[model samples]
Target: MPLSEIKIDDEVFVSEGTVGVGAVRQVTPRELTIYIEGYGDIAIGPDHIASAHDGKVVVKPETLPGAIQAHLEHVHDGEYRRPSDT
Candidate 1:
């Protein structure tokens, strides 16, 4: 989905690469502003987020230190989910 479709109270994985549930404070062409519970209001560029639906976003488990790194290395190999052409 396009970032324009995201709304308040949406849980998103931000470009900072941290997953958090943030309440949408505002949305503009250049940015999406949200107030995350512990992080306070943070404005992120619209290009820096991907939505997570009901915990369905897949991230390789990071219990081991190298796992997240390995996952990062391969994250761009394919489109995990492609937005529809709508």
Candidate 2:
């Protein structure tokens, strides 16, 4: 599925683990951010997404760690813009 088709509040899932499910919070040219209940926010690349159906996005579980790392790096690099800052 194409990333551009994703909408706010859409659910996201992974092949394994509890990290899979979350609600779409934000989307940027570089990444899509989801707000996982109790887990906070996480970001993943559209390229890592395997499919989208029934208003949900399924991402490759193997790419999760790397996506998380990239998200953290992006935050550390001061590239992330918080909603409050807008």
TM per candidate comes to 0.42, 0.60
State which candidate has the highest TM-score.
2
The weakest ten consecutive residues by lDDT in model 2 span: 72-81
What is the per-residue lDDT of model 2 for residues 1-86, given as tens digits with 9 covering 90 to 100? 46777877878766433234567888776788887544577777877788776668777756667655455333334335468854
On a 0 to 100 scale, what is the lDDT of residue 86 in model 1?
100
- Quick one: best lDDT, which candidate? 2
* Cα RMSD (angstroms) for every candidate in the order listed: 12.5, 10.8
Residues 14-62, candidate 1, lDDT per residue (tens digit)?
3335544445677676766766444466576534454435532222224
The reply for model 1, stretches above 4 Å from the true place, is 13-20, 52-86
Residue 75 of model 2 has an lDDT of: 35
In order, candidate lDDTs are 0.49, 0.66
